[model samples]
Target: MRPPKPTVAIISPALRKANNGNWQTAHRWSRFLRAGYDVTLASEWAGPTAGDLAPACLIALHARRSADAVARFADACPKRPLIVVLTGTDLYRDIRSDPAAQRSLELATYLVVLQDEGPFELSTAHRGKCRVIYQSAIACHSHAVDSEYFDVVLVGHMRPEKDPLTAMRSLALLPDDSRIRMTHVGGALDDEYLRAVQALQAQTWPLGERYSWLANLPHAETRRRIAGAKALVISSVMEGGANVIVEAITSGVPVLASRIPGNIGMLGRDYEGYFPPGDAAQLAELLQRASQDIGFLTRLRQQCAQRAPLFAPARERAEVIKLVADALRPT
Candidate 1:
């Protein structure tokens, strides 16, 4: 007979929307953990009383959103493991101002930072409690249609923080004969972004050229397009460990990411595809060179390939299990 399953509570800020990174990670991690454990996904704690909420382990996402649950676990059962997963804002912003977030980090039995360099921002005292786990990716098989003119695709929600407009602006700066079309795929988050996308699409720029903008493609269809594209551009102002980046690399497509800590941690500091954040001119120049210069494109592809190994499903699972084992070990 099978042994009893270890019941675990998985919490995240986004439960209904499958587009967010935290939600996908929570769902995927739960599926993997289900072999040895019974996992239930919850947006927040639903205990009748403070003392009623209990589980063998609690895995919480976001430093601020999950802070209260972390504290409750600390008060109710200090011995049980409380794993807190930090997001982009939590690692780079929230911890600086939110007292609850700070307390959550301090009270966690073990902390899971999605990218490699996440622990450096923590105090030396709290550093030892952290572990790095790159989110896993599932490679998809798609028709990588040959192309004489390289295609560039950008996949991200049209939010202010994502700076999706910069991609089009940069593409506009390219010379007339660059032979590249930058396609922007994302849902507009607000009126401002929608207007900006509309205006950019109609503008006579990028050597009097324009890119096709799709409102939002289905997840699987998006992956197929990404796999066949010459490159994927990530122009985010801030990111924790982007689900898009992992998806791009897993599909063997190259990525030109912004030079931010979040992107650097996953792609490595020396990656050749970085451009200054929000700099349209620089991004355009790089895009022009990546299309005209064969060597530059090859280097970018190779760099992504090297980084791809870090995000394998088995590797992530093993890293997570090891961290759990270490945290549960008696001192």
Candidate 2:
């Protein structure tokens, strides 16, 4: 008789209902592993019961939020492989101070990070076990962009960590003749943020009269919008590895990113499209230059194209498969 496939449990703090990066990652991974393993995904895993068969491996997303599940899985099956995937907050904030997050790192047999620079944040003791897995997005051909105005799309929720205000404030700083039109996507997480955006929209722009907040569209539609834009802006104060950045690059849309480690990690240290985080004036200048300077836009596109292969589906699938195979191998 043929042997049954080994069961692997994937614990993600966010679910389909959340419609966020964590859920997308979990869902994608489940599909990738389905051929070789029986994958089960949940917000938490209590482990197999006394009479039930334990999973051969556990993959948990978000070290801080999924710490309890990681601990439980390790306690329940000491010999079983446990993998913990780190997020932006985990690397930039949580692991530095939170005990639970730190413990998760120690307990995990292996650690996964979404981008190349993530390993630098790990302590020397845990660094050896870490691996980089860049996320993938299907390539979409560039759509015709509007010629009347230079559209710059920002695709992130209205959370403080995202620094949505930088984009908003930058619009006000643009010269009156500048044709840059800013489009902000993603759902508002709170009433205050919603009000702030609404307030910005109500103002008469000293620059070109174009600013719209199309709060939360379906993922497909968002990607379509991104593919059609002149450029994409990522203003996050922190990001483990933004799926949106991958989407933008795959769609042939150049990116203007904040000069933070996460963005730097994905775009490379020498990419010319970086502005200091929260510097509205600098962001405004870049927007103006991108709209007026074709050479600058071409450079950004060239750089993004060079990095595109790293985020290809085949590469991601191979890495994920290897990660699981290595974890399941007998010592």
State every prediction's TM-score relative to the real structure.
0.92, 0.97
C-alpha RMSD by candidate, in order: 2.3, 1.3
Which 10 consecutive positions of candidate 1 have the poorest summed lDDT? 45-54
- Model 2, 106: alpha-carbon shift in Å? 0.5
Worst 10 residues of 2 by lDDT: 201-210
Q: What C-alpha lDDT does candidate 2 achieve relative to the native structure? A: 0.91
Predictions in order: lDDT: 0.82, 0.91
Best by TM-score: 2
Q: Write the per-residue lDDT of candidate 1 for residues 145-234, one digit (tens) a residue.
A: 777677888988888778987887786677777788877778898998888777876777653355878877877778878887888899
Alpha-carbon runs more than 4 Å astray in model 1? 1-3, 16-18, 48-53, 204-209
Error of 1 at 154 (Å): 1.0
lDDT of model 2 at residue 40? 94
> Clash number for model 2?
0
